[model samples]
Target chain A: MQMTKQEYSKLVDKKSPPSKKLKNCIFAFLIGGAICTLGQLLMLLYEKAGLSETQVKMAVPVTLIFLACVATGFKVFDSIALIAGAGTLVPITGFANAVLSPAIEFKSEGHVMGIGAKMFSIAGPVLVFGLTAGVVYGLVLSIFRLF
Target chain B: MPQRTGHTLMLPSKPSVTGYAAVVGKKEGEGPLAQWFDKINEDTTVGESSWEKAESALVRDALALALDKSNNPPSAIDYLFAGDLLNQCTGTAFGLRDYNIPYVGMYGACSTMALTLAQAAIYVDSGAAQKCAAATSSHFCSAERQFRQPLEYGGQRPPTSQWTVTGAGAAIVENAGPGPYISAVTLGKMVDYGIKDANNMGAAMAPAAADTIKTYFEDTNTSPNDYDLILTGDLARIGSDLLYELLGRENINIRDKHNDCGLMIFDLKKQKVNAGASGCGCAATVLCSYVFEQLRQRSLRNILFCATGALMSTTTSQQGESIPSVAHLLNITI
Candidate 1:
């Protein structure tokens, strides 16, 4: 017989208890916002590095992957994520972080099949989309004489 | 694999006229034993391997009860769709293999039960098979032994801890049922929180539940008020509250009808289930014993059981990465 907190709460009828609800929400909000802010900071760094718009876009993902790899190596990302909720996942940083994290951890198995292949596991969709979008953009530019 | 090609069979099962089924494992006079694993501490003498076997035994019995009540021969079932917390699906495969039913192994963490049930219902509804049994099993001892270490290997559980339940549950869905039928299902969105601790799966699964619940309402055009109960697999105490807050933001007030199986299964004071148990078996056993029984008695008209899972790997966990979660919704009309 599985029981829930609500049922337990009802059984005891203990009102005016510490609110676990508020704590979790605030915890998720603050940490999640912090992660996004960090991404913004990275973006600023990319611009200050004197990179062009295209280069900055590319570098941002690279930086995210690197940061995620380091975080994963240090084993800190998941702990922070437990508090932040979706705040860690919504940004482009999350995608890059996911891709690189797996590659670095799997490196122990082998290089060719392990690090090389697994690193792109999560990023495969991004590459497909980027290539498809690039081709579409190129075709449109050629037709419109924009590039 | 028995592949039968024929016309689609749509059972005109109304939500109001369908009967339901249920099964529980703990024998009579064995009070509160079904969830004994939640109370197990790091210093317990029980070996992890033994716990795994015990968990498997419970699940096997529960599954047999569900199958017996459904009145379907084990051989007539098309596939045994199942999963568990153990590496390589040890409990599900071992507990059910002897029945000689074709197995379609799946892994979606704790949310596996609803995912399997939803898929099983689809097979029956689409005329893919006359009967398909979708079942999942989980054991805290087995999970702890495999994922972490033996219970006797005392270790401090962090604040984000969620106790794994030692239990197993199964459900049978048939095409010619004159009972509760699965109406629709909603798969959860993959959501990640940068929390790297493997101890707290409940928190990891919250966003997945929020995503699926929101999607279910949007897709089905059904509000939380429409169902008698809106249950989540193993969100436990913390995750359940998290889900409530998330849903509240969307103006989907489900506090009154919503519940978590992890939190509901034991006496927290006497048993002292730290955090709460969230696994494949948690929700499976609850649905089979509590929810389905209510449906059979016509005490509840409709139910939306949303099982949630954290799709994380040991490598990902050791790498200090956040967990990605998925949730699946099974709408049962009685």
Candidate 2:
């Protein structure tokens, strides 16, 4: 009862089981590698179909996004992600699922305010920071080139 | 007559549990305590279009079942204390809207079950009402969308993370009946041990649970051995251990007599619920069905049911404030 918040948190940390980081890493690596290989296969297939390099490059991600959206709709993505950990999450498909899920979830709240607004609830930070970083990097490169 | 003993109130009027019912979704129906529930809807949504509606439907079904079992019409109930793990307790409000009962909306998070029961018993014991009802619910989908993530969002849960139960429970309490009575209650103090992790709710809630249980025991001059069971709401694996450790620090051992509703409701290993089941429904369903059945059958004589809740919103967690938790205790006996 006399224990401070710091002391109690320490006790909680000591008592609570740690996440299986190494196991998760291994699973993530294997599953993520598989997804990348599949993407490569899709690219090779697109190239064989006589598509331009740029078209193949664009086609691969679109295909991956389509598949991810379907999986999200079918509600099987989370099951796979459970075992896959960051495997499913680090890919483009993960971003697609992240966007699509909230849209589907908030569909009941109506389209404009619910789906449109909340579609980016989870992935909004990534886009904002991603674009910001890109702009900053481009600015930094231009500044260096001016010399 | 109601008598105050320290922080606990002894309900000498014996607010009797006349009827109790639990309604659960598909996942809960597949769980270990499935047989105990009154209704097990194979559809998680309960044929409702949205997750929020499903949760409301669960609350409605649970209350209807309890009322039917009580052999009392809705008009007979004087007051209804109900809540759920939803924004503004909308699940309870919408669910019971058609019932036309005088409603007292509660917000105890997962601890809403015990909180409602305590309030209902107090109302009955104080002669404010001849009959009252306590009800609460939580939907996995609704809870996830509100508190965590969208249903299809792929994210791994931490080991200490709990699965919110998609269920509801209701109990009708009367001034007198063939008794499994509400004998006493110990209202908890808000206790925060500076636990900031939202995923690790057990850690956030354990201190309050330990505090309330200790207070109840001290107030009643009773020990862990005095009760057949010391039931905690949703302190799953980690929180339950922390509670035992906290109590043991004061040389009060409840490990032998303790059983958490979280642990009892789900088969952790097979269900893959990480720590255990949580949410208001976790405790509510287990208590209304299994515990109530045991009490009625005279299998368990006395129980100290303490339901703990992590009183933190997503906004509070994002604001870096620690989860302040409360646990409300009820002394239920046959």
Candidate 3:
């Protein structure tokens, strides 16, 4: 009861079972690479379809996001995400999942309150700072051009 | 050992668990304790349009089933103690509204089940309430959207994360009944071990569970061998192991007689639940179904049921704060 913070922390720290980091890293790398490779294949397919470069670039992420949403609806994304972690999370699909998961879960709360309000709960902070930075950079560029 | 042990209330009046009910959704129905549950509905909608309403329905039907099983009318009950994994405990508020009984809405997160049992025992013991019902519920859809991720999102679960059980359970305690009686109770204290990650709830709750278990043993002058089983609520695989280690360090071995509600209700291998099942209903469904059955058949006697809860909200998690948790215990004898 009188234990110091360090002692209490040490005790709590030891409570978590040891995880297989090396094995996990390998899985993350392999799965992440596989997803990226699939993305590349999609990009190639779109490019070979006589689409413009801009269209192909846009189609790749949109396709991936669509696929991620589909996989999530099927409940198969968690297994893949489990292995690839950042490989899935660092990509656009991760953001899609971040939005989609909570939205569908709270669909019972109604669209406006549940989906609309919480749609950005996960990614809102990132969006806020990202948009702010973009506006600041745009202003700086415009100021330089004026000078 | 005398009934009045350390930090525990000894009920000399002999209150009993007269009736109980368990209602679970599809996934829980497919779990290991499928047959033990009183009602298993594939349609989680429960004739309702919304998930929140469906959750309310789950509790209402569970309380009704329990009263029917006990052959007691709703009007006969004196008090109703209930809670759920919902904002403002609205799940219980809306669900039990039609019951028309004096209600005490509580929120102990996952630990609400045992907390209710302990509180009910106190009332029944002192002759304040002749018959009282305690219920707790959790819906997978409701809890996920509120606490974690969206249901349809392809987000990966951390190795330490647990599945929130979609279920509800209710129990009736009476002053005179032919059932398992409440012998004692050991209340838990809030314990924070500085764990900030919300995904690893088992770790956050294990310390409180350990403290409560140790205190119960010390107070009752009993050990692992004294009871047929020592059950902890919703700790699952990781938290259960942590509890084992912590108790071992304290030199009180419970590994032999210890079990967890999270691990009991589901087959981890088949369910693919990362750590195990959690939520307020985790302990409720297990206790009302499986544990109650065993106690009914006289196969188990002098069992300890301790439900644990994580006291953290989305607001706290966003602010980068540690999860504070508590565990409440009940000593039941058949």
Highest TM-score: give the candidate number.
Answer: 2
How would the candidate models be sorted by DockQ, starting from the highest?
Answer: 2, 3, 1
| Model 3, span B1-334: residue lDDT tens | 2156678888887688999999999999999899999999888777788778888888898899989888899999999999998999999999999888999999999999999888888888988889999999999877876787666655556678889888899999999898789889888999998878888898889889989988988887889898999999999988888787667778888888989999988888798888899998899999998998899999998899999999999999989999999999999998
Candidate 1 error regions (>4 Å): A1-147, B1-49
Worst 10 residues of 1 chain B by lDDT: B1-10
RMSD of each: 15.5, 0.9, 3.1
| Docking quality (DockQ) of candidate 2 | 0.82
Give the local distance difference test score of model 2. 0.94
| TM per prediction | 0.62, 0.99, 0.90
What tens digits encode model 2's per-residue C-alpha lDDT throughout B275-312? 99899999999999999999999999999999999999
User: What docking tier does model 3 reach?
Assistant: acceptable
lDDT for residue B282 in candidate 3, whole number 0-100: 93
TM-score of chain B of each: 0.85, 0.99, 0.98
Q: What DockQ does every candidate get?
A: 0.02, 0.82, 0.44
In candidate 2, which residue ranges exceed 4 Å CA deviation?
A: none
Q: Per-prediction interface RMSD?
A: 14.3, 1.0, 3.3
Report the C-alpha displacement of residue A133, candidate 3, in angstroms: 5.2
In terms of lDDT, the poorest run of 10 residues in model 2 chain B is: B242-251
Instruction: Sort candidate 2 into its docking category.
Output: high
| Tens-digit lDDT string for candidate 1 (B173-242) | 7765566667676766687755455776776677678878887787667798899999999888777877
